[model samples]
Target: MGFADTIPARLGNLSFRISLDMSNNSFHGYLPKEMSHLRQLKLDLSRNLLIGQILSALSNCSRLESLDLSYNQFSGYIPKQGIGNLTMLKKLYHIYLTWNNFSGAILASISNCSKLAAISLGHNKFSGQIPNSIISLCHNKFSGQISNSIGNLRCLAVIDLSANNLTSEFSSSELGLFTSPNRLHIFKNCGLKGNIPDSIGNLSNLVILGLGDNSWTGSIPTTIAEINLSSSFLRGPLAPEMGELKDLESLDLSNNQFSGKILSSIWRLESLDHLSLANNSLQESISDNL
Candidate 1:
């Protein structure tokens, strides 16, 4: 087997205009602090075997627009002086650092990066309440209620906070505040309770909704298209109004307490491709037309 190699410190001497992409490699060792010298617009070192904390010197790369260091073994708290200092890069927009061993509270200073449109920090060990300024954060150790401040992001379109330690009830008022969103996934047992809010109908652009594997009670909201609500405590008859979702493609309601015969209108969904209603009390026989 070939031995792993380290990034050369000499690379820092290269022209500041050179963008570097060293992803999906077997390179192992600490990221050389010398790399901070280059003022590239994009830097990608994801899917590697690198270790150690990110250098605070990276903050010096004033022209950086995109940075990706995901799928590495890098551990320790993200240097406040390192990432937080990037707010000066007025053009910086995207930052991806998922699937690392990063732990600690997400820096509050990140709120200053107002130009940032997307930052994926999922599958890490991050804790504490999510910063209101962030757009996407998932599969971490975060704990606290879904902040109402999230409603202020009127231009926001996508949000996935699944698989965290959030222990709050679903708030209808909070859901109603969002005016623009097409995808929302907050599932995989995040300790959420209460009914699926009727206010969910306010999201006219919503096409994909995943609220499964939580502690949800009450009936499913009838104003959705694609949906997943399996493994919850929801009961009662499947609403016949579900037939109104003519664009529905997938629906999963397994492992619930729903009882009653399957509605005949469900069989007429011309766009339906996937459907799962297993492990429920439904007494309907399969329709011959299906």
Candidate 2:
């Protein structure tokens, strides 16, 4: 009786009215089947050692909203049908599954949770080009290209898909017979491969771009220097004229096949904090002023 093995019986009525905090306990084994009985529970069992499939019985808790089972050892695809039915909890918002082994394409069941302000599935094993609607976070293990439809995320601001296998197109051929302008759009650390798209310059309001760590071959977009296109697969020496973007922060064109002069344009990055032009073929008059 001294062990916290099950949901405390005295709190059943209040389960629907308050958030459950059973996190950071020694609880193990499959969640007891009776968890489905709490009709109003918004449970949080993160940071434990819970495992097994997210049970389908969760659908029975019709009045339930906001479930967090993150930071556990749970694996397998999120149950699709059961979670899709929780249509009434318009206030349900946060889902944090970081630091777990949960796998598969995200449950399209998430669309039912449309009011969700954030979904954190970082440090896990999700694959394929992420579906853009859900606004995924990729780092160090996933791969694939950022779908251009991602430009449609009008409210998106903070996307960190760094340190993985992300690749994308830079420029088609030249700026002459092209579609739009040359704006390099690279969401890194996914298996996205190929050259950078020249059309990216059309995204005139872009900030915090990352196209590093992939197989993209082309010249850096000149317009990109005027903007803030940093940490990407930029080839050739950075134009001496690049020190133009007044709002640049992190420029990491490292670990690729870029060659040419180390532009003092780097010094123009008045707001630059992290600059890594390492492991590229750069040769020119070095400026100590930068």
Candidate 3:
């Protein structure tokens, strides 16, 4: 661990810099605005004790491609003129600002970064409707319905908005917009309700799905694999067609209101290694064929 103190202002005077990594240090105090003078391609100051608002002057780093300032005590809204100005940098592809005290609405200007592939902004105090451009935003205080505009990001392959205060019913149209073949969708504990859209069957490329700890009301989507819908309002017979998901390895429908005889076809799932149907109105015993 490095000694805690303000970063030296003189270090920013260096020219032709390509990268600077000062992460996992004890550095505290506000980030120096002068550091933006270095035209670096990547800058990482994460895992530090840095505090105070982010300086808008940092936007001067026109060549910066990646910026990571996570795991710090940095608070206040991400300045629209500050970090938002980085949209002009066409090469910027990644931004990591998770585990901070940053609050307020995520700037819509972020959508201008067309080349961006990944961004992590979880574990913060940010609140408000998510920007249509963002793909990953979890563990925040955001409320309101998830905008249908999110479906416009055709290339988005991951969506994690878990642990928020949102109280909106999951929309089928919003769910069907995700056409990405290899996607991981997680919306656990976001206060979501309503039936699980049958349109979910369209996500043929979905690899992992987590929608647990909400108030969902519907039968299990028979086509899904590696699903977790535990602790919800879901009721009805466990779909026998679930046997069609030959690739399913984990299925958890516990703590629900389902009532019916265990389907005999479930024995056909050759790849399933984990199964939980506890706390339901299920009847009958496991077949002796096992």
lDDT of every predicted structure (CA atoms): 0.79, 0.58, 0.81
As for lDDT, the candidate ahead, 2 or 3, is: 3
Error of 2 at 96 (Å): 2.0
Most lDDT-accurate candidate: 3
Total clashing pairs for each candidate:
0, 23, 1
- Per-residue lDDT tens digits for candidate 2, residues 166-213, read 555434443222232223333555344566555544455555456555
Q: What is the lDDT of candidate 2?
A: 0.58
Give residue 206's error in model 3 in angstroms.
1.0
Q: Rank order by lDDT, top first?
A: 3, 1, 2
After superposing candidate 3 on the true structure, give the runs of residues whose Cα lies further than 4 Å from its correct spot: 2-5, 287-290
lDDT per residue (tens digit) for residues 174-202 in model 1: 67556555455344557888887877877
C-alpha RMSD of each candidate structure in angstroms = 2.4, 5.9, 2.1
